[model samples]
Target: MSEFGQVLRGAFGPARVFEQRPLAPLTTFRVGGPADYLLETRSSDEIVDALELAGRHGVPVTLLGGGSNVLVSDAGVRGLVIRPRGGAIFELDEQHVRADAAVTINGLVRWTVLHGLGGLERWAGTPGTVGGATFGNAHFTGQLIGELVTGVHLVTRQGHECDVPVADMHFGYDRSRLQDTGEILLWATFRVERGDSDALRSTARASLAYRKRTQPLDLPSAGCVFRNPEPGRDVVPDGIPWSAGALIDRAGLKGTASGGARVSTVHGNFIVNEGGATAADIRALIDRCRSEVRRQFGVELREEIVCLGDAPVISRS
Candidate 1:
């Protein structure tokens, strides 16, 4: 054990902290090596304290949100993994909702629609958490979380907490300043719009039905593997429409496999762990698909899935 790990164990206590914890169960991919140390924080204060301890001792810290869009390496992660508590909701203004970083995106969407909020209706069936959504600036059906984001509570590297306005934060397609900066998200507020309660419910149901029909929501896969590239820029001003999925599927990339990871037969863009999939397996499959797609269509695909750990390297280039 390193000096930082020892100090972390002492400061946070061994009971709540896990040593050499497997990260597979914590992620949607169900594949990854163990994290050196895993800290499950229940409150914002704990999150600040644990991260501060890691920083003081020169230990790296990786915040695990819903773990939906990430691919952890087979060799696992070094340093510490911080996972905060989930499913806490706070009511704000009449048309606003605040939620802890750990609440799943599906849960938030359901709550928003139940309360007559229409803006989040289209996102009702999306997987993952609000923090991941915000960090990735997630969007679907012509809406980005950036549009509804009003503010975020940030815990910086120095363990200082501040309320940040979304406007002051830079957001591009599926990216935000929070991702580059060493800041952990505690909570966020969305400026939702009020609508007829029954109508909102219907909209949510319709959206959910649409997702069931289109996406491979039931599979064990990160939502979309790639952010649509620049060529489909006309679909949404800030995002790529006529996505890589459409292109890949059109190129007959669906159900393609390199190893254990296979492009979902149900949805070409989703690379799934049918069973016993490894990080290397998924990377190989992703690269093969990207390469083949680029060869056939002359369009390159950008991965939306975030890779962690020392997983095998596969380049489409």
Candidate 2:
């Protein structure tokens, strides 16, 4: 460990920090090597301070939420991993809901239902945190996070805190400008409408059931692998009306394996980490499917899962 690590240890202590801790246990996929330094923050203020310290010390930092939609390298991350825990800050108001960046999307959906709010129920089973969902512009029922978000509070890489109106956020299909701009989301306020509690619960339950039935929710995997491209009004064979998953499925890539990673048998778009899978295996499978899809259908699939760090490459063919 370096002298900077020693100083961080003195400031944060052993309980909140770890040296060379395995990230596999922290993520849903159960794949990845250790992070050089790990910091589990309990509040946004703590996050801001940690970011500032790491920035000043010239150490790279990666923010981890639920760790649902990422694939980390086997060689491990070179710098610090900051994990934030959201609690009562995700509470609801009369016509709006506030969620800390670390709050799970599923938990937020449940909160909306409990508070008699509508709009987020369609995303009942999403596997990431509110910040990840917003960063990715996640959508269900033709509704994206941008539509519900009223405001976002974030700390920039330079350690300045600011509130951004949702209207100012540039949101596209499965992509957010905030990601390119490098803003660390702290929390968000979402505007919602009143609805019957029982009705909201029923809607959420139905959406959850549908997702569980279609997606391989029992396994360790990121939600989706590719963004659905736009299609012309004509629903022809060359049109992009169908999703990338359907395209991969039609290409006969479902249940295909490269090392320990497999295109999910239930859903072709989800690449699963079978027991003892490595990051290289996932990357290989992603490449294989992308290659085959392009060769067979002429449609290029764009990755939705965020890849972090560099590792040894694996060959699928």
Candidate 3:
């Protein structure tokens, strides 16, 4: 073990921290290199402790949630990578539900539905965790997840834990204050209402069915590759649908390939790994998809996925 590894073990125990840990298995895409130091945090205390320790050591820190909407570079990540594994849920009252950041969206939805909690029942098939959804203000059926977030618990970049109400979140399409503040989400409390379990289950089933039909869930993918073009900012051409996938399809770019990566025929927006796909291949395909959309429709499709490792989280180029 290196000096830093020994220090990390002293603070967090040897089993809690890993060196050159392969990250591909941790992500939905099942592709990526390794993290120089990967710490599995089981509690908020561990999270802040690791952050403070790494900060003092001058090592960069990156937080990896339930890796759904991300593309990791083949070169791997530098410094410390923290993956919080805390999973706890609570019904604070008749109107609120608090979930640990690591709780999967599907798990939360199921838990709510079982308990007859209605507000989140409609989001049954959403990918990633509560933290990821809150971070990105995840959207579905014209609704943003942040709209239901009543409050959030996060550890700031300075390694201090704080709870902020929804009013301060600055939730917008594919964004939240966490994006700007660089805070690590630990838990989120959401608004809820009592409802019939049967009704909620019906809705949940419908959502799962819709995703199964429209999304390329069979292959390895990072979900939608690009955000749909915003109105006024990017005018949609006549006869073309306003969705990102539609634009890519209209551009005749579906099934487009770069190495093992290919734009899914089921959904033009998803780039799936057929087999032996590299992060570089996925990235090249993303670039091609954007260029083709721009050339054909004069609309530049923005990325919705996060890219990790020696690059900006979201690649504009």
Candidate 4:
């Protein structure tokens, strides 16, 4: 074994750290290359340990949750990739619920509804973990997950555990301060109110149904490709919807294909891997969609799904 491998074993134990780990299977898109080193951490302590070790070695750290919102490069990711496996949920007090970052958004929704909570029912079919949701300010029709967050516990880049109030999160459309701070989300606390279980479940079911009808859920793809452009800044033709999907559809790019990746006919914003797609194929499709959208409408669409590894972002200009 190499000296570096011995060091990894020292920190995480024998065979716990996977070297040259293929990252494709871990993502919703099913298309990344590999991680130089991958560790599945069962608790926040392990995650912090990984961070500290990587920091000491000057290696980069990437936190992957349910892997729903990122596109990894075909060239793969460098340094350490940490996947948190913690999934604990607890009631902090009346009207407050605490969930570990690894808790699936759907699981959290179900638990909340089953426990007679109302606020999270609309996220019933959301993919990815609570940490991913909070990191990206995951949104549905009229709600962003950040709106309900009371606080979040995170490990900062300096290896300090701190609680950040909602006010410090700087939540906005598809954004949170975590993106800039290099903080690893440990857990988040949300505020909820009592509601009828049956009613909450009904709402959850309705959301699931809506997603089924409108999204191409049968295939592998990162959720939404782009953030909807602001209506005030980018005016669409009258009668045309101002949403990102509608804009892509109006640009006549639906069902477009690049290798194994194709723009979803069900939703113009989703680029699904029909089968055997590569990160390059998916990225080519994204570029095509963005270029065409710009040609048809004077709006520049921003991506909601983040690119991981060393993938080069297509110039928005």
lDDT of each residue in 132-204, candidate 4, tens digit only: 9999999999688999999999999779999999999999988899988878899999998999999999999
Score candidate 4 by TM-score against the native: 0.95
Per-model C-alpha RMSD? 3.5, 2.3, 2.2, 2.3
Query: Per-residue lDDT for 212 in model 4?
Result: 96
**TM-score of each model, paired residue for residue:** 0.89, 0.93, 0.96, 0.95
Candidate 2 residue runs with Cα over 4 Å from true position: 90-93, 232-236, 239-241
Q: Model 3: how far is 279 from its true place, Å? A: 1.0
What is candidate 3's local distance difference test score? 0.89
The whole-model lDDT of each prediction reads 0.81, 0.82, 0.89, 0.88
lDDT of 3 by residue, 195-273 (tens): 9999999999998898898999999998998999888778999999889999999889999888788999999999999
Ranked by TM-score, the better of candidates 2 and 3 is 3
> In model 1, which range of ten residues has the least summed lDDT?
232-241
Give the C-alpha lDDT of model 1.
0.81
Cα lDDT tens digits, model 2, 229-273, are 566521325543478888888889999997788999998889888
For candidate 3, the clash count comes to 0
Model 3 C-alpha RMSD vs. true structure (Å) is 2.2
The reply for model 1, stretches above 4 Å from the true place, is 1-6, 231-241, 311-317
> Order of all candidates by lDDT, from best down to worst?
3, 4, 2, 1
